[model samples]
Every structure is written in C-alpha cells, then in structure tokens.
Target chain A: MTNENNSLAEKKTPPIYPVKTKVQVSIIFFVILGIYLFSMFWTQKEMVGGFSGAFENMFTVMEKFFPPNFGVIGAIWGPLVETIQMAIIATTIAAILTVPLAVLAARNVTTFKPLYYTTRTVLNILRTIPDLVLAVIFVGLFGIGLFPGILALVVFSLGILAKLISETIEAVDMNPLEAMRASGGNVYQVIWYALVPQVLPQFTSLVLYVFEINIRASVVLGFVGAGGIGLILNQQLGFYNYPNAMMIIVLIFAVVIIIEYISTKLREALI
Target chain B: METYSLPPKPKNSLYKKLKMIIITLLVIALYVWTFVSIDIDWGRAIERAANNFQRVIPKLFSPDWTATGEVALSMLETVFIAFAGSLMAAILAVPLAFLAAHNMMGGKIFSTIGKWILSAVRAFPDLILAILFVVAVGPNAFAGVLAIAIGSTGMLGKMFSEIIESIDMEVVQAMEANGANKIQILFYAVMPQIIPEFLSFAIYRFEVDIRASSILGIVGAGGIGTMIIFASNNRNWNEMGTILLAIIIVVTIIDFASSRIRNKIV
Candidate 1:
C-alpha cells in the first residue's frame, strides 16, 4: 500500500494550461496593460482639466444644441436630396465596377497567379485610404462639387465591394464551374452560367450593404466642400448658428436611420 | 421524322413579375432623377483637373523627407489616442453588453433599450462625434480620445452582446446545480467563455480607431489630419504625400498585428 501510494504521488498531473503558455499569456497581458497605461498618460497630458472637467464642459456644450430650429428643414431639403442621390449614383457605379475587379482578385476564378496578386494588392492599397481623404483630393482636383463627392464614394466603395465580393466568389461552389469548363464552355460562359446564379443573391445583399455605408459617407463628404448637406452643416457651424446645425444633424440622423432600415429590409429579402 | 411535342414553358408568378418590373422602373427613375438634379460645373472641373493634374499628381508622388519627424510624432499620438480610447471603450462596453445580452438580462425591456442606445451611438460618424467632443473638451487630443471611445463603444457593445448570447449555457447550469450564486456563475463560467472574444474584438476596434484617430486632427481634435488640412491649405502636395505614406504604413502594420493577435486569442 505504501509503495502504491508513492507511485501515485510521483505521477504527473496535467495542468489546465501549460507552464509555458501561462508565462506567455501573463507577459502578453502585462505588455498590453503597460501600453494602455502609457497611452492614458500621454493623451491626458494635453487635456486642460482632465476627464472630470471635460465631462462638466460637455453638459454645457450639450445645452447649445437643444431646441433644434425646424425652420431650416425646408431650406436644407435640396442638399439633403443631393446627398442621397450622390450615394445612389456612387453605389450603382461601384456595384457595376466591382464585378471585373472581384473576379480578377478571386484566386479560384482568375487562376493566373500574377493577375490575382496584382488586383489584390491594388485593392488593399485603395482600402487603406479613408473616404474623406479621397473626397478632399478629388475636391481639390475637381473644384468642389457633388461630382467629387460621388467620385470619392465610388472609389471608396469600390475597394470594399471588390474585397468582399472576391471573398464571396472564392467561397463559391467550384464544382459547377469545373463542370462547365469540362463541357467545353469558355471562361465567360462558365462564369455566366455557373457562377452568376450562385453569387447573385449575395452580390445584391452586399451592394445594399455598401449603399448603406455610402449614404453615411456621403453625408460627411460635404465637409470638404465636396457638395452635400455636410457643406451646409459646416457653414452653419462656422456662422455659429447652432440651432441650424442641430436641425441638420437631426435630419441627417433621420435620413440615415430610414435609409439603413430600408436597405436592411432589402438585404434580408435578397439573402 | 416524328414530331415531338414541346414541354410547356415555365411561367413566373404574377407577383414576382410585377415586383421585378416595379424595382427596375424605380431604379431607372432614381438614376434619371439623380442625373437631372445634380449640378456639376463640368467645364470648370475639366479645366481644374487638367491644370492641377500635372502639378498635384507629381508632387503627391514625391514626399517631403523633411517632415518625417513631425509626421512620425503625430502618428505616434494617433496610436496613443486609439489605444487609450479603445481600452476605455472595451471597459465601458461590458455593462452595456451585459445589459443588451438577452441571455444575461432578465427582461426584454432592458436589452431592447441597451440595443437602441448602441444603435443611436453608432449612427453618428466618428468625425461628427469628434467635432462635438472638440467643442465640449476644447479641441485637444482628449476630444479625439473621447470620440473614439464613444464611437467604438457602440460597435464593441453590439459585438460583445452577440458573443454573450452565443455562449454555451451548460456551464452556467452546471454551476447553478452546484449551488453557485448568480455572481459566482457569472465569474466562473461566463467570464471564462467570453473574455477571449471580448479581448479580440477590443483589439480589432483599436485597429479601426487608429484609422479613425488619424483623421480626427482635421477638426483640430488632434492627429495627423491637422497636418493634412494644413498641407492642403498650404497646397504642399509633397507634405501631403509624406503624411499619406505615414498613415498607410501605420494603418497597415496595426491591422496586421491586431489580426494576428486576435487570431491567437479567438
């Protein structure tokens, strides 16, 4: 009995986590904590009154935006409609342009390794630049109008749509495509017959999703003089007409919510 | 040759046909309305592009090396703002997530309210939030931090609640069977299940916040965007080029690192 007990005691029990893993996890946790602390310190240094004071200031600032002037709604209607139109045009253009780019980028579809890689790289670079920056650049070139705003939204949405659609394409059933190829169909025929039917619903859903994003983006594009309700809002704010700015903000909120609701419903029906 | 009878053609439902036709017409009308309503000075745009294309395009390609230090410093501030804001949001979102998670909350009312609050927060773009906070906090880096924190909280809270809802309840049931209290069950079973995903999402939000914070400086909230605005105002395309390069490199690196870390965690 004593010998058996000794052997049992000598047996190694498995741990919930290995010692090495525990050490690594602890080190990582500490590193993250350290970074967070340093960041808090650095950012707080620039604040005049710190967090408490800022909170106090926020309440006072909030008071200025209350009782939004409904009087500006009639005046702002034209620009508001323009914003929606800009989003619609951009989304339509992007959806149309995304097909070729998405196909080229999808590894399973393109087959040619260099072409796939080149398209992928270009899309990746394009996605890194923010929509507003694109708008600013386009506005600089085009001299401030709805055209630049639409162009910016198109480029921005194109990058995102291409990436998403390519992923969807890559995940598709290749068997049908292979069967079409084996039946002596050309590349376009195979894609049209086999691939299109499979991806159409998802493609429509993603386009609606991108449209929702474009609506939100187009609203802000006006800040850079790219033409939209945002330009009016910026002007109102500059003129210290908080009531008008508040009204515009409220209208934007309403339009955004309504459009998103409609888009979401449409997307649900599609997918 | 014997004549074979052709099979009957498949007929679409009347409702489906009408729906398709109506949708098509609506789309066409929308396009027509858009084209007619939009006012574009095509001649001006064309002339401006022609002249600016030569000047701006070339300068944008050749970056100003002299502004490297300033850009790097601003970029670092951008990172710091993102980190601080994301951490704040990660912590702040926990209660909201719990409130929003139907499995965790006792009634539908609180969860619905929680969800509404989150969506409301999400509707405002980060730039607009930054603008508000700049006014509130006197136009500093702190405002950017506040904006990012609030903006990220909306998304993080929503994601975290979804994660909570999807968690396995068997562990909680087992803990309850062992006579564990609500708090005990939550700490022992619930926290262990959701912590990894929560951390992963928080880190991912940090990646997004970095991109967001980089541009907040345009409103004087503080980041590389201030330099961008100044550069553009000064028409210093070379400086703009350098700033753009810095943003791209930083954003890409952060995205890569965050994704790697998130993959490891989740």
Candidate 2:
C-alpha cells in the first residue's frame, strides 16, 4: 500500500529540465561564433590593399553596366547559338552514356557490390571538381577550342546525370524487376520493359536539369577560350569594352530566363 | 478466366525494323557530325596529356608540409565564408520561401516575383558573381562570402518553397484551426516536417559552397585557389602540385564528413 502511494506521487511530479544539455549546446554555438569572428578579422587584414578602394569605386563600376548596349546583340547571336548547341549536344551524349553507367552503378540492378561502389565513388569524385576547372584542364590538354568545352561538359554532366538516375533506379519498385527476372527475361529486356518505364520521367527531367547546368558552365568555358559567347564577353572585359560586355550580360540573362522557364515547365509536366 | 495464346515470336530483333534502323543511323550521324564540328584532335590531345602527366605526376606526390600552416589558415577562412554565407542565405530564404510558396501566399504575383528573383540570381553563375563581387568588394574573402550568399539564396529559396508546397496540408490546417497565429503555426506545424529536408539541402549546399569558395580565389576573392593560379601562371608545377595535393586532401576530408552529417540529419 505504501509503495503504491509513492509510485502515484512520482507520476504526479513534473520532469526536471536537462540544464546540462542546454549548456552544452550553447557552448557549441559560442565556439562556432568565436571562430567565425576570428576569420572575419583575419581575412580583412589580408585583403587590406584592395579592400577599401573597391567600395569607394563601386559607383563608377556600376555606371558601366547601365543602359546596356543593345547594338551588340546581333554580334553575340552566333556565339550564343553555339553555346546552346554545345549544351544540347553534351546533354544528349551524357544522357545516353549515363543510362549504362547508372545501371551498372545501381546496387539493386548490378548486384555486384564492389563494382557498384567503385562506379559510385568515381561519380562522386567527378562531381566534386568544378566544371570550369575541367574545362581549363581539357583546354590545356587539347588546346583552346570548343572541343575541350564539349568534352568537359560530357564528363561533368555524365557524373551528375548518372548519380541522379541511379538513385531513381534504386527507388524503383523491386517487385516488377523480380517478376521480370523470375520469367527469365534478359537484363536488357528487364531494364527496357520494367525498369525503364518506371524511371523514364525522372531520367528526362534530370537530363533537362543537367542541360541547364551545362549551358551555364559552357558559357564560362568559353571565357577560357573554348569558343562561345563567353569568349566574346571575356575579350570585351579584357579590353575594357564595357558596352559590349553589358550587351552580352543582358542577352545571357534573357536566354537563361527563357531556358530555365521552359525546362521548369517541362520538368513539372514530366513529374 | 480464359487463357490467351499468341503466335510464335519473330526471330528478328526490333532493330531490324526500317524506322528503328533509320532513327539509330540518324542519331549516330548527328553525333558524329557534332564530334567533328567540335574539332577534338584525339592524337594531339593524347600526346599533350601524356606530356602534362609527365610533368605533373612526380610533383603531385610531394607536398610542402611547412606551408600547411598557411593553407590551414586560408582553409579556415574558406570554411567560415561558406558557413557564414549559408547561414545568411538560410535566414533570408525562410521569408522568401514562405512568400514564394503558392499554398501559403495564395497569390500568383508574389510567387512569380519571388521566382523571377531566384532565376535572375541563379542565371549569374557563382563564378561570375564572385568576379563581380571581387571587383566591388576589392578581392576580399568578404566578397566571396557575400557572392555565395546571394547566389545560394536563389537555390535555397526555390527548394525551400517547393518543400513547403509538397508538405501535407492537413497538419497546417489543424494548426490554423487552432488559436495559433501564423508564426506559431509555422514554428509548431510546418517546420517539423520540412526541417530534415531543409538541413539536408543546406548541408549539401555547404559542400558546394566549399568547392565554390575554393574557386573564388581564382578570381581574386582570396583563398588557396589564388596559390594554384599563381603557380600555374609562373609555370611552377611543383607549387601547383602541392596546392593540388592540399586541395584534394582537404576537399576529400570535408566531403566525407559533410555527407556523414547530412546522412544523419536526413
């Protein structure tokens, strides 16, 4: 009877707050805060030479990009088209290649654990390096041209497209695949009739996403003399031809918006 | 149920069809044409790559351990820049995301404006933004951080808004049905479901930010990337090799750690 009364009293009491855990969390936040403050001061000191002068001249620099030169539009059209084409070609090639690579990489599809991991690791490392860096290296290897840009895009987009598509494959219904296998369907047939149907929408959407990224990346690649509007933009910037640079920037902005809108709509429709 | 019987399958494959054959041939021809147009000189490229490897391979093995201190200091800045930038973006993105969510905003105008802002910011690649900021902010790490923050806001806002749109509306409705205010409902109901996704995306963005910050130094925004470009310009392969080694090590370590954290969060 006394034990039962004590248990009832214990249940009625409110639980105490964990003050130590709160303190620990606070300590972590403070430490991070301190580090951030220290880095800010250090960077400020290091950048002393050019730092203050930049802000002072900001107004003058802003003047240059204004009232963008509309006349330079015609001149940039060809290179702009070249840039779009490069992206299209790269996206197509990468999308096709990614299919086989993605299939071989997906753990459920491949069943070869080691091969799956190795391919996945390759894709991860490939994705880490910036597309611009790849273009720069390829340009050095192959000489300055569009070829290097396309190659870089192919390699870069392949990494992204493969990873995304492989994940989609992993998320697919396993029952359908099992049924296909039980019926003695070959690997190709299983993929075509069962796996492909399930993942096709995601694949197309991912391809389009990669294409958008490739377009932006290709423009930058052109800056390193890889042959696109970026090459022209870089030249103008190099010569301090602000008017021409302004025009290129405007055109780029417009093109990017249109492409993004179209791709976004398509993706929405697919999904 | 009645069982249906079919005729025996054809011996020939689907590729034997005239339309399929034509389509395949056309695709191959188009690819070949693009390949040729791109002017990829396989032989010359192979030779040059071989020569580059010969120069790079030996130097890549050796790192300047003494310079590790300086590199570490710079790396701290890179990390802080990424952290601070993403934090800033996360803070800014919350309100923008709320406004951008169609279900929440109940108006197309605001969402359209939000989306336009996002796309405009995104259209200018981080590299270009870094360049512009470097020019504006004087080649400082502050510029790097701010540029990343501005660019990141675009992506974060878009993604966060989408996450909001996809959330189960019942929970939100329940909160609204109660005496809770907008802020209270947001905090108590909408946030819990979206927190994991938000954290996952933020951490992934941080990883990208690290890589982005590394490259910003190339445009004079200040980091070890400046060292790589310097070494490259001076033809100091040994120094470049050391920088590359440092980068590969640091990046790989961070990449591993962040993904682990992200995995736990999601």
Candidate 3:
C-alpha cells in the first residue's frame, strides 16, 4: 500500500482508510459481542432443555395439538365477540385522546420546552409498563370484566398511538401550516384546514394499526381474568382441557390473520 | 395592473358537508355500539376508577423497597430469556430469510412457501406462543425462551428477507462472474452488505423480547409478569405498584442503553 501511494506521498496522500478508526470500531464490536455471547450461554445453561430433548418433547407435544378440537368454537363465540369489542372501543378512545397529546408532544407544534420534556417523559414511562402488568392492575382495580380489559387496552394503545402521531406531526411538510398562518388564519383554523389534511392519512393508518395490536393484547388481558376470549382459554388450560384450549387458540389465530389481512389492505390503500 | 388579492374562502359544498357529517356520525355510532355490546359493570368501573387513583398513585411513591431485590432478580431472568431467544432467532432465521427472498431463492414456489410460513408464524403473538410452550415444556423459563425465539424468528426473517431482496444485485453478479461458489458468494458478497442491517434488526428484536418475556409469566411461561398477577391477586396494591415501578425503570434503562449501542453499530 505504501509503494502504491509513494508517488503522491510528497503531495500529502490521505490514508486509503482510517486504520485507527477501524481497529477502534472492531474493538467496540467485539466487547459488545462478548457480553452478548456470555449472556446467551448463561441463560441457556440455566434454563431450556437440551436441543435433542426439546426435539423429542416437541414431537410429543405435536400429537397433543393434532386435529384440534373444533367443537369448542361455538362456546367461545360470545367471548370472542367481547374481545373484538374491547379492541374496537379501546382503539376509538385512544385515537380520540391522542390528538391533543400528540400535538403538544410534537416539538414542531409545541415550542414549550418544558411541556415537551414532561410529555415525552410521561409517554416513555407509560410505554415502558408492559401491557400485561397494566391489564392485571386494571383487573384488580375494577374487578374482572370487559371494562378493565378495555381500560388497559386504552392506556396501552394510547402510548403507541401518541408516539406515532407525534412523529407524524413532526414529519409533516410544515409548509401548509406555515401558509395558513401567513394568511392570518387563527390557530384552530390553521390546524384544521392545513395540518389536519396533511396528517389525516397517517392518523387513520396508525389507528388501524393500533387496532390490530389491541386485539391481540385484549386476548392476553383475558388470561388474567380481565374478561375476553382469553379468560375462557385460561380456564380451560387450568382445568387441563387441552382440546378446548386448542380450539380457542385456533379461533384466535383465525381472527388475527383476518384482521391482519384487512389492516394490511387498508394501510396499502391509504398510501 | 393591480395584482388580484386573495379571494375570500368559499364555504364547503353541501354534498361534501353532508358526507363529512355522515362519516363522523357513522364512526361515533360504531364506537358506541362496541362499548355498549360488552357486558360491563360500568357503574362499578367508574366508581373504582376514582378509588384506584386514590389507592394506587400514593403507593407508587412509597414503593415497597423490600421487594426490589425479588423484582430485580426476576427482571434479570426476563432479560436472560430475551437474550437467549434473540440469539436463537438470529441463527434460525438466516437460511429461512434467504429462502424467502425472491432475489436469492430464484424459484417462485420456494419463496412463496417461505413467505407463507413466516406469515403463519407471525400471526401468533408472543404471549400466545408462550402459552403453547408452557403446555409443551411445563412452564419453565425455557418455555419463555423458546416462545420468544419462535416469535422473533417470524419477524426477523421477514425483515431480513426484505433487506436481502432490496440489496444491490451488481455486486452479486460480479461475484458470480468470478466463478465463486455459492457459499463464497454468500459470504463474500451478500453477507458483507447485510450484516450491519441484520445486526440492527436482531438487537431491536432483543429489546422487544425483553418487554415480551416479562409478560409471558401471566400464562406461566416465565418472568416478572407473574409477580404482577400474584400481587394483584392478593389485593396487594402497594406490592403491585412496586413491581410495576421496577419494570418501568428497568425497561427504560435497557431501552436507552441498547439504543446507544445500536447507534454505534448502524
């Protein structure tokens, strides 16, 4: 390499690549990699059956779930509808509530530094709480019913919806809002006529996306007696009714796939 | 000639105005119907909502500090499970990702099959996957690990395949022209380009798996989620507050720390 660059040496040839930086980069990489590998090894040793044992167990388990009991589907229809209803109601509330919070949280919309920081911090903490814990807490608070499930879904989806909408607001082509303001439009008029149009598409798309998340979340919330299809599934499991549990799983799976398909199509159309 | 001044805004046409009102009404009706259909004790819920605020928020400030040790240990267990799961997914997803990518797979049938499998696996959420594993392995942390790995595979494989499909074909063509073997081309051409992105995706999945494994406990698969259930069951709102606070703190710390590391890599 030195020989090839000799002719340009007197003219101050730059190094082809920064050897110093490359070494530093790899050193950092290896250190992180080392910690990650050690953690994996420790966890594997502490838990999990061996690979061969798991394979054997997997096969045995396969037999238990085979030809899943479809008979239980009829019994679960009411609870399944309850789960869907929980998602729909929660999503509507979250979408409606996100409008003001998202606007205030957005740096572009709110120049109040303290407000942005406070809102951001609160949202982060909200997002950090696992949805399961939220469900369990709500269940305990309000007693077991669809209300707690709906409430949990509201808070859970709010964290997601607010974050997404705020980012969307920030990324909007600021020109339209600016144009309206320049035209002497009041704040409400500017937002409604200019900013709303720009973000309407994404806002709708994100609401549909959050609705999908809420459906799955509501099912899990039911496991903790929060009230939905998962409650029945958990009851069956606790009673050692594998076939019934299998049936519930299948029904939920079908619903998830159908919802996912519809949402995907809707999202694509929005774009 | 004087420049024309901006015209006053025109009112929305009656048809458009009526259409807007109809849409708004329809949405409100749907929301109301969904709310009313559920069998809920709204009176109790509203009553408890106020009681819960009085009962819960105060406890959060005085978090039962004694439970911190137990909570932290289980939080570590959750992180360990997530680590193991993410690594497993990273290893398991590569070949499947290659098979799924149309640009790499070459055959429509193979890629279609791969895509279908990914979609099927992705349909089940981690908590549901945890339930299946609990039944399989009798509710150990290992079950949580397996569940997380399987869940992560579906997503990581799909994202990986997408990245592979969008990669520059020119480098691959050059390598093939040089008479490189399949493995040689994969390593010398494809791997170099996608490795950074794959790492980022895997790391991101690990962060997500941490949040997921914590909740896997509700179904008896493993982790701190069971702590919340237990605390709630015993009507120990203070203990529940402690558990929740621990989770929030731990998860936020990890999110920030991991994101910083990610920035260095990508």
Candidate 4:
C-alpha cells in the first residue's frame, strides 16, 4: 500500500506553470530587459553630465520659471482666442467631411470591397503621419499662417473621425436597415431612415472628443509657425523670458482643463 | 385617397423648441465670428502655392537617397528614446496605479489625489514637457527620454488603475480567508490578473511614445524632429522626403508589431 501511495503522489504532482510557459516568459522578460539596458546606454551617451548632473541642475533650472508674469495675460488673450477658433473651425469642417468618408470606409455600409479597402488604406496611411509633421509641410506650402494650421487640423481630425464613425457604423443593429430595404426603400432612403438616427448620438460624441484633441493640437501647431498662442509662447521662450513663458504655460494648462471638462460633460450627455 | 391626412406631426414642447433655436443661433454666431476674426492672407498663400508647389512636390517624391544613412541613425535614436522612456514609465506607474485604484487603496482620499495627479501630469503635452526638460538637461536624448517618461506615466497610471479596479476581488478575499498576508494576496491573487493587461498597455504606450519622441527634436530635446526642423529651414525638400518616409515606415511597423504582442499578452 505504501508503494502504491508513493506512485500516486508522484503522478499527481504538477508544476504551477507549464514548463513551456515558464521558459517563454523568462525569455521574454530577459529580452525586454536587455533591450531596455541597451536603450538607456545609447540615450545616455549623448548627455553632457548624464542623469546625476541633470538632477542637480533641475531645481535651479525650474526656479527660473517661477513668479510668472501675469502682465502677459492681456497680451496673450488674442492668440488664445485664435487658438480656440482654429480648433472650432477645424472640428466643424472635419465633422462635415467625415460623413461620406466614414460611410465609404464602413464595410457593412459600403459593401463594395474595392472602395472600402481603398478608403481604409488611405486613412491608415494618413493616421501614421504625425499632425506636427503635417503642420510643418503645410506651413511650407502656405507660408506660415493660420491657413496652414487650420488645414493641418482639418486633415488630422478627419482621419480619426472617419475611423471612429466607421466603427460605430459597423456595429449598428441591422434589423431596422433590413426592414427599410424590405419596404422598397432605395439605398439613400434606407440609410437616411434607418442608419442616421442610430449613429447620431455616437457621432456627436466622437466629434466632441475629437474637438478636444484638436484644441490641444492647435495650441502646438504654432510651434511650427502655423499661427496661434504657441507662436507667442515660442517667441517668449526664445527670448529667455521664462516668466512670460511660465504665464503662457499656465494659461494653456487652465484652458485645456476647462475645455476638456466641458467637452467631457457634453459627451456624457450625448452618449 | 380617403382624405385622411397623415397623422398630425407631434408638437415638441416649448422648452425643446427654445433649446433648439438657441443652439442653432449659437452655432451660427460661432461660425460668423470665426470667419470674420481669422486673418488669412489668401492672396499670399495662393501666390506661394503657385510658385513653391512645383519645386516642393517634385523634390518630395524624389527623396535624396544620400541622406538615408543620417535619417536612419536619428530614427534609431528616436526609437531608443521611446523604449527607455516607456519602460521607465511602466515601472514608475505601478505604485501610483495601486494608490489610485479604489479597491487597492485604504482611503478614498488617497485615490482621489492619485487620480488628480495623473490628470494634471497628462494635461501637459509631451512637447511642452520636452521643452522644460531640455532646459534642465541641456538638450539631449536624455531630455527626450525624461519628457516621454513623465508624459506616458500619467496615461499608464490611469489605465493600470482601471485594470486593477476591474479585477475579480473574490480571489483576493479567498486568499485573505486562507490566512494570506497583504503581500501574499497581492502576488498570489491580484498580480496574476493585472500583469497581462499592464504589460499590454505599456507596450501600446511605447508605440505612441515613438511618434511623440520623433518630434521632440524640434525643441532640441533629441530625435528626428531636429533633422526635420533643419531640413525645413534650409528648404531641403528631398531630405524632408526621406525623413517623412522613414517615419511612416517605422511607425507603421511598430504599430503592427505592438498590436500583435498586445493581443497575445492580453
């Protein structure tokens, strides 16, 4: 009986993690660690005094930004409004343009495989390009002004809005659409009667979300000479006017928080 | 045919009608203000496009193959900055995530403070942070890494906390009933549930960090953006073309690989 019990215990004992999984996890962990070590070494090579020196200088450097000049608030108000206007204009244009592109990209709505695939591919490629890069190019083309900034924002927001709205289109309940088709409705009539109502709330929510992103983006577009509060901020920093830069930064932070709060409330009410 | 008019359209309440009219009027006023206030030099823009369009568009297509090596090196630096930054953020966010997670924290106040800190950190764009770090660190790849690290931490912390909150608590309770200590319960019950998602989100953040770090160079924080600014200033469209190509290819590849890994991990 003792021998039989010993054999049963030996046979029943199992490892907490399968041997294969253990090996894989360890290997992955080590590989990631190795990559991280290499990256740190490479990046640190370019530093003048490395992390230690930077840490020592950080406090003193930060001190230069304090006692922010509230005087600039009056000066910056104009560009601040320009920044907000840029976002609003871009969001509006993008929202209107996204409808058709979204429909073409949605597989269930478009149904034509070639058209859907082409639109999807174009949008994917478009998204891969950073908004800053787009702004830079348009500034080159349009000679550094609000036009380039607005154009960049419009293009950037279009990619995101189309992708989001298309996904919402794809997930809609098909029963109503099918019923409309059965009632002898044409394609346009069916889409208008069945699809629009279902997607309107979500579309509005997504557009609001994109508008928040646009607001953040438009603030930075001025860095590349695209025109807005960022242009003034950049100039102040260039002049080594840390106090004014600090003021601008504070203003940007407050505006961003306020706008985001309002947009979030609107989206919550929407969806 | 029976002279039966369609059922009378339902009348909206007075409040609803007023609300609709107010919204419409506000929208129209907004557009009117925007168009009138925005100062656009359409004439200059049209003129510039006519002259520069031919010169720029052609060169953009025919990239300077000679600049590929320089562009590739800078692109590699951008990747390294992103990787190091994202990894640091992943580790740094752990304690904050636990602090913010309502279930993990002992007091609601701590969680609320944690949440506020995360959002505040998130409010500053990576570029803005890069500018500050560049001043402190004297404009190097390390500055880029620091900016990316801090910028990513806010997002990662929030996501990790959400993951923690969504975890099944019954297992933790069972561990407690079995006389397990806090540390034991965390390791044996909680970590197993959250680890996969944490790693997945960290990897995804790495992808975003790459794109972000690429532009940090604009402020001299280090990466491809420095090259871009130089190229644009000199009107070197061919070089800009190569840089653009490199960004698109690298971003696309990283996004693909990261998504695949995230799928497997989660």
User: Which 10-residue window of candidate 1 chain A scores lowest in summed lDDT?
Assistant: A6-15
Sliding window of 10 residues with minimal summed lDDT for model 2 chain A: A42-51
Question: Model 2: which residue pairs collide?
Answer: none
Best by TM-score: 4
Which candidate wins on DockQ? Answer: 4
Tell me the whole-model lDDT of each prediction, alpha carbons only: 0.89, 0.78, 0.84, 0.92
Off by over 4 Å in 4: A1-13, B1-21
Which rank order by lDDT, best down to worst? Answer: 4, 1, 3, 2
Clashing pairs in 3: none
Model 2 ranges with Cα > 4 A deviation: A1-21, A47-57, B1-3, B6-53, B56-73, B168-172, B191-196
Q: Write the per-residue lDDT of candidate 4 for residues A85-143, one digit (tens) a residue.
A: 99999999999999999999999978889999999999987887888899988888889
**Residue-level lDDT tens digits of model 1 in A75-106:** 99999999999999999999999999998999
Clashes of each: 0, 0, 0, 0
- Mind sharing the TM-score for model 3? 0.88
> Whose lDDT is greatest here?
4
DockQ: which is higher, 1 or 4?
4
Q: How would the candidate models be sorted by DockQ, starting from the highest?
A: 4, 1, 3, 2
lDDT of 3 by residue, B1-266 (tens): 88988689899999989988997998798778776676777798878777777776677566788888998888887887888889889888998998899999788999999988888888898988988887777667778888999999999999999999988989999989977779978887898789888988898888888889888888776678778778777777778778888778788888898898789778
Writing each residue's lDDT as its tens digit, candidate 2 over B140-222 gives 88888778888898899889899989999998888788666889787778888898898788777887788777767766777
Selected candidate, larger DockQ, 3 vs 4: 4
